[model samples]
Target: MNVLVTVTEGATVDDEFRIDGLAIDDGSLTTDLNEWDEYALETAVRLAEADLVDEVVTVTIGPEDCEGTIRQVLAKGADRAIRVWDDALERSEMLDVGAKTALLAAVVETEEPDLVLTGVQSADEGFMATGVSLAAAVDYGWAAVVNALEVDPDERIARVRRELEGGVEERTEVDLPAVLTIQTGINEPRYASLRGIRMAQRKELAVRSLADLGLEASAVESRLRLRELAEPESESEARVLEGSSEEAAAELATVLREQGVGR
Candidate 1:
């Protein structure tokens, strides 16, 4: 069985950043393979390493600038990469969950992998809804926040442990043709070997537009609009009580009383 992993080029903000109108200024951000998606890709690569799957492929919705990040995953273990981008995607204020789901569903239809893996959420937006939403759109069985996975291609089953609220874990089995949003800490991602890095340069990396994916320009038009983006205003200030432990404790108590925290 082939596995398809959804990946993204997530932005990391500098310690100090500037808000450029409705978003962080590009100059103040650095892009790399998304942390969560790295774990998902690691899971797929491990499955391939264990001979549980035929191929491990990755798909991303990003611009040409993200090819370096895509190659990082390829070097680590994905067999090839598919990147989807178009003028519409570049022009949009933001690709909402629905728009992203539509784009991914089109690729899913074309690829038709038995299993699909995605990070629990993208670091930048943290919508935490794309994987499940894509499953719904594609009519695939899915589980979210999965921390453990065991796949049986012969039986067409995938058993997973989901991380739930209150430190709860739910173990369940999903049928074949399922989507699983993998959680971090499920596995230790391996670094790319020197040989692997060299080999990645020659691997197939296909770029497709919405039209190529059998989608129209409207597929990327977001229903949601981004109106404001800014740093949150600080609500309170912290003061250091400099003294011995006992004196510091006393000062802390006095400050709490002044703020009516212990009333």
Candidate 2:
């Protein structure tokens, strides 16, 4: 069995964003791999190490700078890496659900992996749709928010436990050649070791284009448009109740009851 995972580029901003425009950072912060995607990749790597999967591959759809992130995936244990990017895509940093799905579907088609995996959501957009969208586009059964997975290679079946609201979990079995979006807390991600990093440097990171994937730039479409951006409204006044611990607890409980909470 072969598994493919998708990685996304996530950033952190130390200062305020450009509220008047798209609320984007001014490149003054730091960049890192998406936290959720790291968990997804770690799950894939564990499967590979356990001999449940014959190989693991990772794909990243971003600018060339994202190659570093892809290499990190390889160092984590993915047997191969694919970097999917184009001039048009690089120009439009934020892709709509349809566009991102199409790109991942193309990779799935090309790689023909027996299983597909991705982070439950991107750290930047937090759309929580890319994995399911790719599954739909590629016509595969999918499980979202998966916390655990088991695969039977001979039967080509995957049993997954999905996390739900209220701490409930649903277990389902899907055939092989399916997609799964992994949730955080599923596994702790490991950093790339020095030896693994050296091995990653020797592995090839294939760069793919939209054209190569039989896709057109115009075919990628966004349903939403950014009209304007602004900072969240700030509350100018909030009363602080000062008292001893016991008094504060009593007062807070009274306030909650008066506010129709926990009544």
Whole-model lDDT, model 2: 0.86
Model 1, runs deviating above 4 Å: 240-263
| TM-score of candidate 2 on Cα atoms, chains taken together | 0.87
Clashing pairs in 2: none
Candidate closest to the true structure, highest TM-score: 1
Model 1 agreement with the true structure over 84-183: per-residue lDDT tens digits: 9998898888999999999999999999999999999988999999999999999999999999999998999999999999999999999989999999
Give per-residue CA lDDT, model 2, range 38-117, as digits (tens): 99999988888889998898889887887888888888888989888888876664589988888889999989988999
As for candidate 1, its clashing pairs are none
Clashes within 3 Å, all models in order = 0, 0
Give the 10-residue window scoring lowest on summed lDDT in candidate 2. 19-28
Best of the candidates, lDDT: 1
